[model samples]
Structures are given as C-alpha cells and as structure tokens.
Target: MRRDILEHYKSTGTYTYAGPYSEYFKSLPDDIRQLGNLICSQVIHRVTLREGNSGANSDLRYGDMTRFPWYRLRCEDDVLMTAAAMTAELFRLDDRGFTFQRATENKIVVT
Candidate 1:
C-alpha cells in the first residue's frame, strides 16, 4: 500500500487526502508525521478489501489480524490511522453508518 501511494503520487503529483481524508490526517504529528499521515490516508481512501492473509495465498499467509481488525477495515492501509479513528471511520463507512451518539457511546475502541 505504501508503495502504491508513492507511485500514485509520483504519477499524479497530487495527494489523496488533500480533501475528503483531511480530517483523518488532522491528528497526526507535525513535520514528517504529516507525510506518513498523508500517505496512509491516501492508501486507505483508495484501496479496497481488508482481509488478512489466508493459507491459500502466500501474501495472505503472514500478518496479524488479532491486533488489527483486518476484517472490519475496508482498506488494508488504514492500519496507520488511529485505531479508534480508523474503527470509527470504518463504522461510518459501514452499512449502518455512524452518528455522534454512536461515536460517544464507546462503540469505537482506539487501542
């Protein structure tokens, strides 16, 4: 995903999170941190499928899904986002959607 973002940026000379994904980048540290945030946001906003590695495929054979809700996240690149925020964002993108009430209700766990 990181490579994909870099290649996309190299080709388009434009960023992914300069618009819709900005809020997710807002919490990132300043300086070089924003670059990481930008790259991550772009990948997450662009890629699809959050499944972990499966024995059926070599690429899916490695990776930890317990610590990361790979199945819940729509984008494999979202691992870089705050766990809480990413979870919330995923929930927001879910069929049920999100609401301020749900956000405050601890439905989203950050750690």
Candidate 2:
C-alpha cells in the first residue's frame, strides 16, 4: 500500500505541491470521501529534497522512507483549519503541531 502511494506521487507532481495526501486519501473508505475531500480542500502541500541531494548536502536534504519527497500539510483556511483541529484532536491528542494559522486566500501561498 505504501509503495503504491509512492508510485502515484512519482507519476503525478500534484501531491508534491499539495503534500503526501494522495495515499492517505486513497486509503480512505467510501464512507469517508467527504472527510478526504475536506482534507484535499484544506491542506497546503510541499515537497522535500530529492534522494540524491543527501550526498551533496546533509543539512539541505533528507530521504523519505517513501520514494516521493516529504510533504508538509499547511493548514491556513477554514477548511484546513477545521481539518487540522480535527486531526490533532484524534491522532495527536497530546501535540498541537497540527494547528496553524489560517493561510492566505491564495491556495499557493502558505501565509
């Protein structure tokens, strides 16, 4: 399942820009489509350094266990804001790292 997600990321650059969500979305059950869509609508995406970069500069790069680059889910809008709060409540009960300020209106900007 993990490998399948990595393959999907390599084939499409969307997840790299949007974060490592395609797999998480795909793993969702049919009943959870709404939640998945909510995640899609709210999370900001980002890509990490390439595999080869580690050899060139350790500080500048790191390898992900998955072949695809590591993605950061930026939470900045109502959709993302809600989602982050929910995710934090459920999975990160003790951690508030998932919480973030509302992003700028532009989807591409993290603000």
* Winning candidate number (lDDT): 1
Q: How close is candidate 1 to the true structure, as a TM-score?
A: 0.23
Which candidate has the highest TM-score of all? 1
Total colliding residue pairs, candidate 1: 3
Clash-forming residue pairs, model 2: 18-45, 76-102, 76-103
> Which segments of model 1 are wrong by more than 4 Å?
1-15, 33-111
Give each model's whole-structure lDDT: 0.38, 0.35
For residues 1-111, write the lDDT of model 1, one tens digit per residue: 699888866452232333444564465456776555433332222212233334432252222333344344433333435434454455555434332222212122222
Worst 10 residues of 2 by lDDT: 102-111
Error of 1 at 97 (Å): 15
Please report how far candidate 1 places residue 2 from its true position, in Å: 24
